[model samples]
Each structure stands twice: as structure tokens, then as C-alpha cells.
Target chain A: MVTVTLNGLSVDLRDRAVLHGISATLRPGELTGIIGPNGAGKSTLVRALLGLIPATRGAVEIDGHDIARMTPKALARLVSYLPQGQALHWPLSVERLVALGRLPGLGPMSRLGADDLAAVHAAMKRADVLHLAGRTATELSGGERARVMLARALAVGAPGLVADEPLAALDPGHQIDVMELLAAEANSGALVVTVLHDLTMAARYCKRLLLVDRGMLVAQGSPQEVLTSDRLRAVYGVTGRIEFGGGSAMVVPLERV
Target chain B: MPEIPVLRARNRALIPLLLLGIALVAIASLMLGAVPIPTARLLDAALGHGDPVVRAILLELRLPRTLVALMVGGMLGLAGAALQGYLRNPLAEPSVLGASNSAALGAVAAIYFGIGDYSPAVLPVLSILAALASLALLFVLAGRAEGPLALILAGIAVSTLAGAGISLALNLSPNPFAAMEIMAWLLGSIENRAMDHVWIALPCIVGGAALLLWDGRALDALSLGEDGARSLGVDLARTRARLLLGVAIGVGGAVAVSGSVGFVGLIVPHLVRPLTDRSPSAVLLPSFLGGAALLTGADILVRLIPTAGELKLGVVTAFLGVPVFLVHLLKERRLW
Candidate 1:
């Protein structure tokens, strides 16, 4: 198992700081939810973690190895990322799209071997997109496309998976389906960190939550500790009630108060 | 996934077919020029056993032109596939995006100012420099945007600016004959071109094509967007830089030798896209072969057209390519 640690990470883009002094440790064995309002720098934090952009200060480390120093391929072997909106350049079939995930494992002249193909198959099956493998990713519904892209990320089989708003365009059913998939991945010993907007799903499914607002981490703890009524109102500007049912917490937004 | 096994087998067989087609077209181009050589005599001339006149025509005249056509067309197609894949835009190409025109503008200026009269090398070197400048201009105008519209707009801007530059140079020419000469050069022709032009362009084209082919896997990963691809081990900045340099060298070399041959790159990749897997990386080699076949075929057809002065190769390609391009545009009208 791998552990991702962010120590006082600050990112400045074109004279403007998007994330400021953010610190957190994301560990394996739990699905950690990063929830924030729009423009809370959630995506920026995730990008910094993946080493897509350099941090302005401090560092992100995977098992004490600084991410900034790692090659893109090396980081990819340790962590897989799913961006917010899936961009499909061609009308590639689902299998080929997912097979792209195994790129780090293969060399330039190497063809996909039995093990790589099997990993892809397993990832597709886990994402519940095995039936859609023959379909073109461009032609799929938004929800179905999300799952296919998720499968592509999972096909990497990296120890750490970081996704930005994976459930943004999904229906409630697909949301749960995706949440269960991430949870299963976590249970299977991969660290899964997803940025979620739906607090109810985040509370019910995410074992830990990192709450951010205005470019800073407002709070981070278990669902019961982080999703309190005062925190919701202060951060989201909504008066909400948290309910406990069937051993899960659900947040019901009362009104914009 | 099950269908992929069969498709792979089909594509594996089709690669050789494409190569064979290119070979046939190359041979046909050699055989069907003005004053056609009989097959027996052509083979004799090819192997150094024919009349001196036949040998000169085959070896000195046709051979260089044929080689230039093959390299120029293949380079265009390969560069087109590479650009399209990098920008994630289907419409990206050397000529359409004004890179060729920019190179031509530079070469035309050189000829107008009498630099080309001093040495043949001056023209291509200046043209290559100009092509690189145009790409740099395109990046500056488009900024960090990654969509088709931004790139297309930037390309059009660069193209129009270069066209204006060419026109201004022609208008300011001291002699009227120079104007006509510049005009003919701009029209692009392989006729009367010697081995010198071939030697000038071939090395750069081959190097650029090799560099482009090396990035096939990275291009595939890039379909996942910048962040996703980077997270998948792709070095986005480095890849973009290499693509820019590769296209500059390849397309620059072609334009330096042949002037601005339009639309072969755009048309060939689109035509070949359906036959192969839709991956941009997979289409690079086929596009190269298809481009060679298309240009070689066009070059030969230009010889057979019976025009008073042989039709310019650029004019021929535009005449054949623009309508096909329009049809593609209409088919994808919803995108606009």
C-alpha cells in the first residue's frame, strides 16, 4: 500500500495563487473525499499531487519520495488520475481507451501482452463496462462514458487513484455504482481519493473527508466530524441537516440560509 | 474487444497491401511521363544499359523528380497525422495552417531579392527558418488553448499574413520576368528539379518523420487530455516541443523544395483514417504510404493532362483536394 502526503503545498498560476498552504495525508484502505465549493482549488490540489504542475512551495510525497522529482512515467506507475471532463480525441473503442491505461507498463515497441489485456479486462469488469467495451467512447452516454474512463484509470492498476469530480455528470444510480467501485478498490488495497460535490454520497461512502474552501483546507476528518451543520453553513452557505440511517450519514440541504 | 482480434489480423495484412500500392504508383510514375519510355528500355536505363539519351531522361530527369514527389508527399502526410494528433484537431495540416505558405513566402522573398540566384541552398535554408517562425507565431497567437477553433483561427491568421507578404514581394519586384518566375515557383512544380533539391530535403524529412513516429504511444495517451496523459506518464511539454520541431523540419523541408503543395496531408489522413484503427499513432505509417501514392499518382496525371505548359503540381492537388475537403466539411457541419 502507498501513502500520499501533501506538506504545505502552494500553487501559483500566472501571478495568482489557486491553492495556498494546503497540507494533508491520504492513506490506503479508505476512500477519501475532497469536497469543496466551486473554485475551491480542489482540482489544483489534485493536479499538484499528480505532479502535472509544479507546486509553488513545499511538496507532495508518495511514501516519503517527493513527487516533483519523479518522472511522469514513474509517478504514473504509482498514481493514476481521472480528470474532471473526459476528453476523447478519436472515436476509439472502449477496450482501446482502457488499454491506454496500461501505457506506462509497456515500452514503445511493445505490444499489449496477456497480463496487460487481463488487467484491462478485470478493470473493465469492475467498472461494470465490460459490455460496452465494443462501443465507441465518443458515442456513449455521459454516465456510461464516466464509467469507461474510470475503467481506463483503474486499468493502470496504480496504488493511488486521484479523480476530480468523477460523479459530476452521473445520475444517482451511476453515482452509487461509481462510489461502490472506488470503495471496492480501496478495500482491495488501493488508495482512492475522489473530489465529490454531493455531500450525502461523500458522507455515506467516504471514510474520511478533506473539506476545502477559498483555497484552504477548512476541515478534514471522519464524516461525523467534518460534515457538521456549522461547517456546512460556513463553507457552502446552506443550512443542512445530517441524518444517520442504516449505519450511514446523509446530509439534507434545508435551504440557502 | 472480441472484434479487435479479427480487426488486428485484417490490418496486419493491409499494411503490405498499402506498401505494394505505393510501389506500383511509384513505378507507374516513372513509366508515364512525357516521352514515355518502353518498359524494356526503362528497365535497361534503370540498370545502366540503355542509350545515352534514354539514360539521361530516366536517371537525371525523372528519378530526382520521382524521389522528391515521394518524399514530399510522405512527409506532408506524416506531418499532418502528427499535428492532428497533437492538437486533437482533425483539420490541422501544414498547408492549411499556413506553415507551407510561410515557407514559400520566405523562399519567394529570397528569389525576389536575388539571394536564390547566388546559390540554390539559400532558398531552402531560408524557407525552413520561415516555417519554424510561422509555427512559433501560431503558438503565440493561439496561446495555451487546446481546441480546434483556436488553432484554425491562428492558422488562418498566419496564412493570410504570409499570403500578403508574398503578394507584396511580387508587387515590388524590379523586373516583370521576376514576377512571372516567382508566380510559377509559388505554383509548385517538380519539373526540371535536379538532385540538389532532393538532397536538400530528404535528410530533414526522414529525420522529422522518424522523430514523429517515436511519439506514437505518447500521442495515444494524449487523447486522455493534458492532465490525464501526464498522470499516465506522458511528458506533455516535451511531447509538444518535439511535435513542433518534427513538423517544422519535415514540412519545412518539403516546402523548401517544392513550394506550397496544398491539402495532400489533410486529404490523405482523412481518407486513410477509416481503414485503420482510429488511433492517430496507428495511422502515421499508412498516411505516409497513402500520401506517397496520392502525390505520385497526381504527379503522373499532371504529365498526362495535355496542358500547353504542364499543370503545376500544387494547382493539381488543390483542384483534386478542395472539393473532397468541402465534402468532409459538410459531413461534419454539426461541429461548426
Candidate 2:
């Protein structure tokens, strides 16, 4: 029911332009993977859209309003985001971490209500972290922590999610589980966008792809339409194969010389 | 009655904190003093009682210092908790940003140049101004950096420079006795302090602590990185500025009157965290009371150990603080 539009967005960090005039649209009910090499301005693009850093030349819009104009709680209720690496401040329980998702819905003077509790319980169930709800987050394995963070994000129940490298530290099992979860979210109507380095997972799960080289959006289409070996080699300096059938597709990238 | 996990956890922490805080305040104000004023005697004197001398000692000498130490301790604790919460670093103290050293230098400047002797108000003013300056400098330096550690490191550097400046002021003094007095004062001893000192810092400490408490939610958002916090609707610039101002002035006022009291901020926050469900807001008032308890106890310890020739409150804190900090380091093995 809603969409995100990035228009001529530019970003600078450490006095250098990291994301340059790159534009993309994220549609509803689809898992759009923003794929690229390391330091390809993928995260920068997300940060720029969230109005974290000042855009040099353009703007990002959610639901047809400029993102910068949206209030923080409003934006959070609409679109949730996760960073590449998030460290914990304390050894909070999984449920406590998930409850922070309801912060946007909470008023300044108001405390959490019954709906908040139900939402937190539902999110924990959805992320499959229900068993770990009472356990300390720090005691969990890396994959478990990732799942809890995902649960926290899903707890927001936003219309759109922009997660940067949510699967980086996950095990192979968790990786697929998280991908399937994202796919399920999209299937259920939320627009889930993720920046993934795993070409295999990206190809298998995402409904659409946006490939970038440096700061430019090099290609955008379905898995069969894009993610070709030639484009992969050009952008990533590597070669890859794409296999499609049985309602699934996979891309395996070969080593570069 | 809310049984949500976060609510339950917070509830578990809050009850003990309330009891312990009240107990600490009671023992601090009533029992731990040089004259050993019993609760009954204190109550009678507080109620305008029978013995004139008991009433006078309780009302005049012990009461002012106790209230000042309590207030100053509370301020440092709150300041420390706020700065630590703001940066999400456990090691941050009120003195981290060179505010204490800057205030000490200001106090030394006032004393050395005879400005403090000129007007009763000149001393705290000089200390506050220099502290605010150091805070501004810290902002300029840290604002240019990416990581929070960089800002803390910058604050350490500023602290060292201000410390050296204070040393230079001592060395340049013409009167050796006065120089030594200023030096000892700068080392932070709360002895022979009068009602005048209390009047000077009480308003500033009270006001600054209120400012720090007002931003509890802002501190919570900052737990999310600037980017994530922004998306959640925190105005980063305004939040950072207000906290910095609060930390700087609160610390400056306390240190100006009490000399350079340290570790109250560090120790209080650490001790209060486990008691506050690790919630920054819950930690705020408890940290303040905890700091007051610790520092006032240290002051009382200083008075009790006459054979040690009246040790400085700072020395007692350092002696206790270093061991506690080391134990924490051994346990956590990581920064907050």
C-alpha cells in the first residue's frame, strides 16, 4: 500500500562522496535486495533515506512525503531499519530488547499497554525467539542475537523495513531462516528491503534486485532478468552462475583472479 | 500489575533502590558525623529542642556540611550518570570532559590572583566560566570525530592540559603557604567548608540536576546510534548540546565548592545500574543518592580517621574506587 522513492540522493562521509545521485524505488509486498560489493554505498543509501545524514543533492520519500519532513515516531511506525553491526549496552533479556520496538508507538509520558505486550509476544513468536524470551541476550549465539534483533525490528510492525547486512553474522541455517522470514513478510504485504552479500540467498529469496557498483545503480530487475555472470564480474570483479527452476533460483559467484 | 517483561524487570529493580536510597540518606544525615548526633538528639534539635549546644551543632555546623555534601554528591552522581548514559560508555564520569580540572584551574586562578578574596561570588563564577569553556572545546573536538571513544579521549586530553595549567598557577604563586593551600584545595578536600559554600553551589547543582533528569528519554534513544535514534525522532544536536551543558555546569559548581571531588559520578552510576533494571531514568535519581551516600560516607571516614591526620575525601574515594573499578573490569571485560 506504500512505496519508498529515492531521488538523486547523494551522501558524503569523511569529506568524501560515498553515495552519488543514486536513485531507487522500493515497492510494497516485495523483498527488494540492494546488492553490491563492500563499501558500495549501500548502507550509506539507507542512512541517507532515513535522514540520518544530510543529503547533498536529493531526498527520500515514504508514502509520497519527504522523509525529512516526517516525525521520528511516524517514520519509525512506517519504516523500520537495522544497522550493519549493533552492540548491546547491557545483558538485557530477549523480550526486553523486543519491547524497544514499541517505543515509537509509546507516548512520552505513557507506559506500555496490553497491546504493546501482545505485539511483543507476537513478534517473539514470529522470530522464533519465543523460547529465548527469558534468556539474557548476551548469552545467545551470534545467530540468536541476529534473530532477536530481527524480532525487535518486526515488533515495530512497520510497512517497510530496510535492513543492512542483517545476515552477516548468522549461521547458514539462520541465514536461510531469516531470508524465508523476510520473504514471508513481503508475501504478507510489507515491503522488506535488505542489503545482502550472499548472492545465493539473494537470488533464492528476493523477488527483485538492485545491483550497484561504486555508487551507481547498475541493474534492477527480477533474479532471472538481472544478476548475470557478466554483470557480476564487472561490478564485483568476479564471475557467477544463475540457476532457476522449481519456483526458486540460485546464484553462485566464483573467485576472482 | 503490568506483567510485560520490561515492566516486570523494572519493577524488580525499583523497589530495592527506593529502600536502599532512603536508608543511605537517613544514615548519612543522622549518624555519620564527627559529633555522633543520635537520631533522637537530631530529631529533638531538628524539632527545635532542649539543649542549646546540641541544637546549635546540629543546626549550624553539621547540618550545612551534611546538606552540601549530600547535594554535591547527588549532582556529581547525576552528571556522571547522564554523561555515561548519553555516550553509552560506562567509564564516563563528571570529570571526564575536563570540567573538574577546568573548574579547579578557575578556582586556583581566582585564589592566586586574589579575585576570590575580592568578591564572595567571584570564585564560583570563575570556576563555572572555565568549565563551560572546556565543555565548548570538548564539543568542538569531539564533534569532528565519528566514535564516542574519540570524544572521551579528547576530554581526557583537555583534562590533562587543564591539570597542567593548574599546576603552573601553583608554581607561579609568590606566597608558598598560599600556594600549598591552593594545591591542597585543588586536590579536593571537603573540610572546614561553611554555609557560604553551600549557598554558592546548591542552586546550580539543583538546577543542573533537574536539567539532566529532563533528558532521560533522550538518553534512551541515544542507545540507538545517531542514525537509528534520528529515525526514531530524536533531535541529535539539541540533545547532545543540552546534556553537555548540564554535565559541565553541574560538575563545575560541585567541584568549585568541594574542590575536585571525583569518582562519585563513576561509582554511583555503576552501583545504581543493577538496581535500576539498567534503565537510564531509573538509574538517574538512585545514582544521585548513591553518590551522595558514598561521598558523604567518605567525608565521615575522613573525620573519623584523625590518626591518619584528616585524609582528604578524594583520597578515600580513589582508594575505594580503584579497587571497585578493577573488579568491574575483571567481571565485564568490555566497555558499555
Candidate 3:
């Protein structure tokens, strides 16, 4: 089983502290949603977890190995990351774009074989962008590009997947569809952590929620515990109304506190 | 699924054609110089069986010039592709960004100081060192935030600084003859070069190109951008460092031999990029071949043009390259 642990992790950017004394644990088969408002260090936390940034204090450990000590190649085999925006410079075909995720698995001189191609195909199917395989990634619409980027991340088939705002440019329907895809990925045994802005969707699909505000982890637990009206009012300055149906939780934010 | 393999196969098939093109152009360049050598005699001279005069002309003159042309062209093209791929900017090239000029300045400094008269090897060594130093300074000044405008601006600044330095050296030279020597070298040419020049440049070019070609896979990963590529286990800093040193050595060697031949690097890659799979790694080798062909062809064109004192190769490239650059700028006008 894969487990990612953050021991009092903190980050300093340009001498300004962005994340401070944040501790969390992500386990296999758990889809964790990180929710925070603007300037709340959500992206920074995700970047640190991916080892894209150095933690100023403590450490981020994956399966008991300090992430900083692992080689990039070794770390890549365990963690797959998808950044927020879809920034494609070249007009590579959609299939080629997804195949980039297979780089870690392939050797320097080794070409893709049946297993790698199968992973690419499976990722495309999972992200529902198989029809756009021949299309140029740069020409795709916002929602389509989001799906294609997701396909790229999924092609890694790593033990842990982290995405920053995967649903940003997507419409409501695609948003729900992507959320379902992420949930399915978690169920398949990867520890999925996503930075999300949609509180209702996070409550619905995420098995655990981590709330951050002003660089500190304010609360962490199930949706019913972390999405409490008191914490929502205090941290987000909005009153949250929670309801349960069919064993799923939905949250509606009332007027600002 | 069918289209992906088909496209890849087509791209792979283009490599041999590019090699063939380079061979044809090299032959044409060797044959079409000041005194045309007949085909049979050219072959005999190539095999060291001709009259001493003909063999001297063939081996001592034409072959070196042609080889230098091919290598410089290939170097320019390869450097352009590597820089463009690494920076993710289509406008990145040694010449356009003033890297070649910086190298030229270094070589000219060697001549002005009379170190070049001591040994031919000193020129390229100094030039390559200058190219690396200038580029390092550029990265330090610009930092990692490579917006299109920021990169172009930084290139302009470096180019201007190198140009000013060149002017200062010329003005300070004690002898008018030394100044003239610097000026001729600055104009750039593949004419009158011997086997010695080829020997001096060959090693640096090969080493630099090997370094660049080795980073091909990493360059492909970089098409995903810094964060994405890094996340995929590609070390961005190391890849960029390797690329800069590679370009510096290759461009520096080209400048020392040919004296600032610009735009082959910039134009050839743009010309051949459409034929590839839109991956940086795929673009590199083809760009190298296309460059060799273009420079060899351009060298032949200048010879056939019947110009007064022959048009400088650098001038021919600038006249052709600048317009294409302008067209690209026009298309990317929104960057302004």
C-alpha cells in the first residue's frame, strides 16, 4: 500500500513563508481534495508534495522514504502530477502528448512496446479522449484539453496522482465526469490528491478533505467533519448547508457570514 | 491509432532524403567554385590520383571549404533546434540571439591581441569560451522566467553588448592592418580555408553535437514545460546547462572558422520542422541535415552569382534570414 506523509511541512518562497507547519497523510484508495481560497497555499502544498519545491522544515515521505532523498526517476515511478493550466508549446498529436507520461517507464534507448502502448490506450479511454487521438493538443477546446492533460497524467499509472485544478476550464458536466474519473483512479488503488475549488463536488467525490487557509491546515477528515458549518463560516466566511442522500454528502454555501 | 504509426513512419523515412540532399549540395559546392573541376578529375583528385596542381586545388582548397560549410551549417541548425526546444521559443537561435556575434567578438579579440597569429587553435578555444560566458551571463540576467518578450529583449541586450565590445576593440587596435584583419574575419566566409581550419573545428563541433543529440529525449520531455517535464523526471537545470555549453562550443567553433555565418541555424529548423512529428528530438537531426544542405547550397550560389569580390556568406544569409524572421514576428505580433 502507498502512503504519503507530510511531517510539519513548511515552504518559503522568496523569503516569504507560503506554507507553515502543515501535516497530512494520504493513503492508498483514498481520494483527498485540497480546498482553499485564493492566496491560501493550495498550489504550493501540491507542488511541495510533488517535490517540485523544497520544504523548508520537516519532510514529505512516500512509503517511508524521504521524497528529497529519492532520485527524480525513482520518485516519478511513484508520483504522477498534472499542473493547473494546459500549456502545450508544440502542436503534438493528442496520443503523443499522453505518451509523454510513459517516459519514466521507458529506458533511454528503449522504444515503446506493447505494454507502454496499452497503458497509453487505457489512459486515453479512461480520460474519454480516445476520439481526439489524432487531433493536435493545441487546437483542442478548454474542456477537451483538460481531459487530454488528465490522460497524460493517467498514462503514468503511478502509485500516487496529484492534479492542480484539473476542473478549472471544464464545464459543469465535464467537471463531474472528471471527478468521477479521479474517484475511479483512487478506487483502483492510487492515492489521488487534487486541488479543487468546487466545494460541493469535493464533498461528493472525495473520501477525505483537507482545508487550508493562510498557509495552515485548519481541518482534515471526512466531508461530514471538515465541511462543518462552523469551520466553513470561520475559514471561508460563508455558511455551509450540508445534506446527505444515498450515502453521499452535498454542500450548499449560504450567504457570506 | 493507424495515423500515429503512419505519421511516425513518414517522419522516419525523411532522414535518408535529408542525408541525400546534403550529399548533393556538398558535391555541387565542391565543383562550382572559382575554377570548376570536371567530374572525372574531381573523382581522381578525391582519390589522390590527379595532377599535383589539380590535387592541390581539390584537396587544399575546395574540400576544406565544402566541409567547413557543411559543418558550420549543421552546427547552426543543431544549435537553433536545441535552443528553441529548450526555451520553447521558436525565435531562439545562436545568430538571431547574438550568440554567434559573442563568439565572433571573442575570436576577433584573439586576432587583435595577436594570439591567433601564434596558433590557429587559440581562436576557436577563446571563441567557445566567450560564447559560454556570454550565455551564462544572459541566463543570470534574465533568470528563468522566459516570457517571449523577455527572452528577445535579453538576446538584444547581449547582442548589443557584444557588438559594442567588437567596436571598442577595432577602435583601440594600434595597427590599421590588424583592424582590417579583424574586419575581414568579422564579415565571415568559407572561402580560402584549408585542412588545418577543418581539423581545428571538427572536434569541437562533434563534441558539441554529441552533447546536444544526447539530450534529445530530455528535449522531447521539455515540450511539456518546466514543471511538467520536471515532474516526469527530466532535470530541467541540467538539460539547459548541457544545451548552453553545447551550443556555445558548436557556435563558437563555427564563428572561429567561418566568422559569424548567421541564420542557417534559425531558418533551416523552421523549414524542416513541419516534416517531423512536432517533437524537439525529431526536429534536431533533420534540422542538422537541412542546415548542411542550405549552407552548402548558399555557398554555391554566392560563387555562381558573379558578384564583385563575391558576396559575403554572412550577408547572403542575413538578407534571406531577416525577412523570414520578420514574417515570423508578424505572425506572432500579439506578443508585442
The chain B TM-scores of all candidates, as shown, are 0.91, 0.89, 0.88
Q: What is the lDDT of residue A182 in candidate 2?
A: 88
lDDT of 1 at B70: 93
Give the best candidate by lDDT.
Answer: 1
Screening candidate 3 with a backbone cut-off below 3 angstroms (N, C-alpha, C), the clashing residue pairs are none
- Candidate 2 accuracy as TM-score: 0.93
Which residue runs does candidate 1 get wrong by more than 4 Å?
B1-10, B96-98, B133-158, B326-336
Q: What is the C-alpha lDDT of each candidate?
A: 0.86, 0.79, 0.84
TM-scores for all candidates? Answer: 0.94, 0.93, 0.93
Per residue, candidate 3 scores C-alpha lDDT tens digits across A1-257 of 58999999999999999999998889989899999888899999999999989899989999889999988888888999999887888878888889889988766635777778888888999999989988878888898999999999999989889999998978999998899999999999889999999988898999999999999999999888888888878888998788866656778888887
Candidate with the greatest TM-score versus the true structure: 1
lDDT value, candidate 1, whole model: 0.86
The per-prediction CA RMSD against the true structure, in angstroms, equals 2.4, 2.6, 2.7
Number of backbone collisions per candidate, in order?
Answer: 0, 1, 0
DockQ-derived CAPRI band for the predicted complex in model 3 = medium
Which candidate has the top score in DockQ? 1
Candidate with better lDDT, 2 vs 3:
3
Error of 1 at A228 (Å): 0.9
Q: What lDDT is reached at residue A160 by model 1?
A: 94
lDDT of 1 by residue, B1-336 (tens): 433342235378557988898888888887888788888998898888878998898878888889999999999988898878877878778665677888999899898999998888999989988988998998898757654467678888998999999999999999999998899889887887789999999988998888788888888888887777788898766676677678877888999998878889888888777676677788888888888888888899889998887699999998999898788767745433
